[model samples]
Each structure stands twice: as C-alpha cells, then as structure tokens.
Target: MTILCVRFQLPSAHETAFPELLGLLEEFTPVVEALPPDGALADLRGAERYFGRGAVELASVIRVRALALHGVDCVIGAGPGPMLARVAQRAARPGVTCAVSAGEARDFLAGKPVAALPGVGAATARTLCEYGLDTLGRVAAAPLSTLQRLVGAKAGRELHEKANGVDRGRVVPNAVSRSLAAERRFPRDELDPVRHRRALLSAGEELGARLRAVEKVCRTLTLTVRYADRSSTTRGRTLGEPTAHSADLTRTAYSLYEALGLQRARVRAIALRAEGLGPADRASHQLTFDPADEKARRIEEVADRARAKFGPRAVMPGGLAA
Candidate 1:
C-alpha cells in the first residue's frame, strides 16, 4: 500500500481549519490532494522510505500529530493506489487505518458492490446490476467486449481494469488556489428556501466585491452548506465565463443551491468560495443583445464605483437588505 486516503472528523465550526490539516499531510508527502470540506488523499511512496516506516505506521503518526497539533482526528485507508485507498477508507473508522496490501488487492475488490468504485454513479451501478454484474468479482470475470457493449467502449474498459484491482489512478499534488470565501451563519437552523437563497446572495456579493477589488476574475464557484447536525455538503461549479460580476456570482450560487434540492433542509450556515482566479482584464464578458442585461451591467459598474467611494454598506442587493 502506497497511498493514503484520509477523512477528517471535522465539525462545521472548525471548517476553516481544513487547510491546516492539509498542510500537516504535506509535511509527510508532497502529493496531497485536498478533498475539501473535510478530507484528502496523500501519496506516501517517498515518505515510507524517508521515515523508515510503512504506510500504516506513518498513518498512526499522522493521526496522532493531527490530534495533537490541530485537534483533528482522521480515519485513513492505505492501498496500492488511489482507488483502493478510497475503498479501504470506507471500511476504516476513527483511530484506525485500513491497509490493503498489493497481495490482497484483487480479493479485497472482488466482493465489493459496483457502486463502491469511485466515479461509478448510481445510474451506472443500476445498469451493471441489471446485467447481473452486481459485484466487482463478476465484473472482473466478464469479457471486455461484453462490458463495452453494455456501457461505452472507454468506460467498460476502465471498469474491467479497476475491477481486477489495477491502479490506473495516481494522487495529484495539491496546489494552493487563489480564492475568496464568504460565509453566513444563521441564528438558528433554517429550513426556508428563501432564507437559504438570501444567505447565498450575501456570500456571492461579498466574494464578487472582493474579487473586483483585487482586480481578479474567478472561473469556478463552490458552495458549502453546514447542517444543524454538524455535517456539511459541498458542491462546485465551473462558470460559463470567468467573472468578477456580483450578479453572475449570485446567479451561479442560486443555481448551485437549487441543484442541491434541499428546500427543507435544516441548514446552519452557507459559505461560498470563488476559485481559479486570474487577471480580470484577460477575462471576456459574454455579450448579450438584451437591453435588460446591458442595463444591469451598466448599473453594476456604477454600483462598484459607489461601493469603492462610499463603503460596502452603501450599496446592497434588494434581497440582502436588512
């Protein structure tokens, strides 16, 4: 086992501490991919040799260090590759690390449900189960041609390869993203969709203003909703165009919230992160013939100027008004 997939037991109140946990992992290995809101995947091939320890041993130290330094405890899974590591993680609990050695890779993957494989969505799992290929063992035994016929040529080939416990995936090193974040916490658990939208609107406006002030444009928006039970759901969307526009940010935030289909959710807080930042001047604005859109942009420019000259509170979207 060379890779480690770690899931941190981070509560919503401590959400901002995720980066520090990622940094701790980086001390062990450079190839740490942040699976945000609370987890990461770290490739530890070099670390094993350097630390004179196995992946599982290193995991114990990591767990202790995380708890000691950050007060964060994590469950870990170690395997030959990212896929196996992720599977091992599901079987692992806090204070323990599940390690899948190379010799047991095939047997370990064999009895798993098709849905256990990464990237195999519910629809794909249903389709595979319908064909009596309900488990990875069956999928591994199936002919490549048959799997291809059932799914697509490329997807079927991948499925067959992964079912046999081959590690085609590698851990990508995490790079720090230049991003802006804003969060709004409700006084109590909120279930109303209108209030949820209001929180999104508030966060978007803050992010957009910060980006514009810094002369940056962001190509992606991430939304994180913290629930009353301390769990959170995170979703990210690539924008149609890079933008520092408040309206565009708010609109995208609204769409992401709608896609969650959690109109009656007991939400505690909403946070928005604008990422993939770059020079605003290099970004192109989508031109539209609609006069309403044109008017909105013109008004937005004026509003930006007003906020700059006066204060952020000088202007606000009607929905965000107190």
Candidate 2:
C-alpha cells in the first residue's frame, strides 16, 4: 500500500488550520490522518484506481486544489509506508511533490543525519555522534545488540527498524479534535513583558485564523509558559461567549499572561490553546450596536481575504510588526 505524507508551510495566521486542511485531503481519499498544526497522511492504496492517477499525479492534484481553494501550498512525499513517506516529504522542496520507490527507500535514508530518523532528538543525536553513529547508514549497519547496549533495548530496536525503513505502521483515518494550539519559542530566554505579549498576540492570531478557517468557535483559551529552567505553568480562562475572533482571543491571552504575574521570569516559550470548539454556525454572538466592534469585524474580514489572496504577511497586527 502506498501512503502520501503532506506537510504544509503554514504562515503564522494559518498555523492551527490543520482541520481545514484535513477536510481538503478527505476529498481525495477517505483514509486521511491528520497531523496536527500543519500536516496529514493519506493512504492511496486504492485511490489510484479511484482517481485514475498515479501517486505523484494525485499529490499534485491535492496541492493544486489546496492552493486554489484555500491559498495553501503543500509539499507531498509518496512511499510504500508512512515512515518512508514522511522522510521523503521532509526532503521535498517547497511547493513540490516527490516520491520514493520501494527499492530506493534504504538508499534514500542512507547517509542522512541520524537526527532525520523519527524520535531522535538533540540529546539523542549528541549521544549518537559521540559514539560515531551519527548517520542513518551507520545506525543501519550497526548490530542490534550493540545499538541496544548504546541507547537502550526498546529505543535501540525501534531506531534499528526506522534506520532500515522497516516501519509497519498504517495511516488510520480520524477526525482532528475540537481544540487547536500554537506555540512560539524564543531564540533565547526572554525577560521582557513586551516580547511575551507580542508572542501571545501572534499565537492568538494564529489560533483565531485556524478556528475561522475550520468554521469553529472556541469557548475557552489556555496559556502555557515555559521557563528557562524547563518548568512550565498553564492557565485557562472561560470566555464570555464562544468566538473565532482574533481580538477576543488576544484579549483573553493577554489577561491570562497578566494573571501569571511573570515579572522578571525568563520565559523560553509560550503556547496558546483554544478549547471547547464547536461549529461556528452554532455559536451565538451578542448584538452589538457599537460602531467600533462592527468596524473591527469588517476590517478583520477584509484582512482575511487579503491574506488568502496574497499571504499571511499581507496583513498582520500592527503591534506585531516587529
């Protein structure tokens, strides 16, 4: 069975729009798996016969539809299985689709950094590099027992399988959950509250756009702050009403951050999650006669259109221009 893994380079505004993207993928195949934030995996075993197109051609079709319909470009990688497909997708160029033949899976994985393998993080890569097992070829060539001794029994065996392109996992079709999240990690520890609020605004904008894209409304917002010491704190607040409005999300995010009273805290990263999501059609908005509220909503709609036609940067919150 062939599987295609697609990764999207979502602009900050569309970071949480994975659900909308998944809906697009479902048009091509029923067996679509959502990769939250910005990606998905589709099983194309029988889709070839159904669509009368090869894997590569079908991938192009998906890319075209996504761009034409939602102004999102996708990179796709096709292979016999999920691991190979994900690896190929990572190697793909922007706005392009690539495929890996079954015979070439090992050759494709060979010579790549060990970090390219799934689940091998920075610390693991350092450990492997110290032992001269820094490449997939080296890992694949190593004895399983030796790898077990180096890493551990379970991780070592899994690494060996992945290094040799031996993944047996299948793409299971499932709906993305009701919540969406976005996070930003600072280049260094950030102590300034201005930078913190800026990050929160960015995340809020992203979550709002995503919720709107998917036609959902969130009734609550959660803010998580990761400190330089690796500890983290999370706070959540219930909104007055469910909303997909960026302004509402931004207000709630700022309030949550302020509640933390993070004076002088060196924050490493900040994340915002929108929860209690439901269809936007089901949400009820209070009647507002205020001209400012109406004006802001109108401007937001125009900005959304501008972003869809041009790119996410076509319109950004003024405060986040820096």
Candidate 3:
C-alpha cells in the first residue's frame, strides 16, 4: 500500500490546535494517523480509485486544500511504504511534494549518514563509525552476521533491512484519541509562585470544561513550563481515577506545579494537556463519602448547563474570578 507522510509547519504557541486540519484530512482518507504537533501519515492506496488520482497527485491536492482552507502549507512525501515516505517528507521543501519510486529507494538511501537511517541512535552510529561504516551504503554492504555481532541479533537484523531500503511495517491508523491542551503565556517573565498557581488553575478549569462538554475524561495530565530562556520542563502523572470535574483537575494541576519546586524561576508560559481520553460513560468514578465533594459536583453540573445555555462567561470558578 502507498503511504503519504505530511509534515506541517505549525507555530509552537498554537501547536495543539489542529483538530480542524485532521477533520479535513479525514474527508480524503479514512486511514489518517496523527503524528502530534506537526506531522501525519495517510494510507492513500484506497483513496486512489475513489479520488481518481495517483499518490503524488493526491498529496498535492491535500497540500493545496490545507493552504486554501487553513492558511497552512504542508510538505508531503509519497512512497510505497512508511519508511521511504518519512525519508521523502524530511527531504521535501516547504509547500512542496516529494516522492520516492520503488526502484530508486535503495539509491536514495545509499550515501546518507548512518544516523540518518531511522532507528539508528547516536550510540549506534558512533559504534558503526568506529568500524568505518559511516554511510548507509557501507552498512548495507556489511554481512548480516557481521551486523548482528556488531549491534545485536534483533536490532542488527532490523538495521540491515532498513539500510537496504526495506521496511515491512504497516501504517496503523486511529490508535488513540487526540489530547486537549491549554496554554497561558505571560506578558513578561514572572517569578512569583502564586501567579503561577493562578495561571495553572485557569488552564485546568478550561481543560476540565472542554472535556466535560465532550463527555470525555482524561486518564493523565501533563504540565509543561517554558522558561524565559526558551528552555522547558515537562512532568506528567496518571490519575488514580479518570475525571472531568473541574475541582479534581485543578487539584492535580496544582500538585504537578508544586512538585516542580520552581522557587524563583523566571517563567514565560505554562501549558496543561489532558491525555489518554476516553468516553465519560466508560470511566468509573470513585464514590465519595464527603458531602462537600458531592455538593461541589452538583454545583459543577449546574454551572455547565448554565454555560451551555447562556455562554462560557455565565459561570466562573471562585479562584478564577480574580
């Protein structure tokens, strides 16, 4: 089956906002696999007869549609399989399409650095270079038994096949639900922890409302803090129980921020992501004995209904009011 790998040049500030683009791709093919932030792989074999176009032509069509509709340009690479498609996509220029024919795949990969081959790590490249196997051509010419002795049995066999431009892996599509993320960027570098907590609270409230509105709950929460110097730190935690309640989500967000212990760090932005989402009906909420907890949940439901009718600004959490 032919596969097309498309890479998007998304701004880092708005990287998580691509649901509309994904929906658009779904119209052309059902086998769209999201690569998060900036890439996707689509299986185009079935789309050929349906769209009356070849793989390369279909890729160009997708690029044009994305540019016209979303104001986003894409680089697409088309090949018979996933590996070659990925390589072609990386080699493609912005707003362009590149394709590797079946016959030319080997020569295309021949003289590239060993590190350029997928699944070849820095340490592996260093080991190979020690033996003067700096290019894919040399690695491909190496005996399979020799590669196995150099690396290992499984990895060596895998690398040998990849160096020869052979990939047997299939493109698995729609494996997981897309995550929801909310980020708040400070106008200036702020070092106060109280301000950081407040920002996190707002982000949590926004994320919780979004999840509840869709009737979904997340199993994990990831917190990312971008510093003034452009460096960032990320931490994630899996909840004991999945929930879409604002209070529960806010509490988890607070805990994650506190765990970082950023006493005087100049923070630039904070982002929270709700991951591993599933249907709310399928998740089991733990029963609470505290009357206050029940009261809070009841109030949350009422607020959600009011917001649905009036607007999102109709209700606001007490902490967020300031």
**Leading candidate by TM-score:** 1
Model 2, residue pairs in steric clash: none
- Can you give the lDDT of residue 57 in candidate 1? 93
Q: Using Cα atoms with residue i matched to residue i, what is each candidate's TM-score against the true structure?
A: 0.55, 0.53, 0.54
**Worst ten in a row by lDDT for model 2:** 44-53
Candidate whose lDDT is highest: 1
Which has the higher TM-score value, candidate number 2 or candidate number 3?
3
RMSD of each: 16.2, 16.3, 14.2
Q: Tell me how many residue pairs clash in candidate 3.
A: 0
Put the candidates in lDDT order, highest first: 1, 2, 3
Candidate 3 per-residue C-alpha lDDT over 277-306 given as tens digits, one digit per residue, 9 for 90 to 100: 777899998887999999999998888777
Query: What is candidate 1's lDDT per residue for 211-316, written digit by digit as tens?
Result: 7665678899999999999999999999999998888899999998989998579999999888787878999987889899889878877877777666666788
* Candidate 3 C-alpha error for residue 26, in Å: 1.6
Alpha-carbon deviation at 307 in model 1, angstroms:
59
lDDT per residue as tens, model 2, 141-173: 999998999889999999998888787778877
Runs with alpha carbons beyond 4 Å of true place in candidate 1: 177-322
> How does residue 193 of candidate 2 score in lDDT?
96
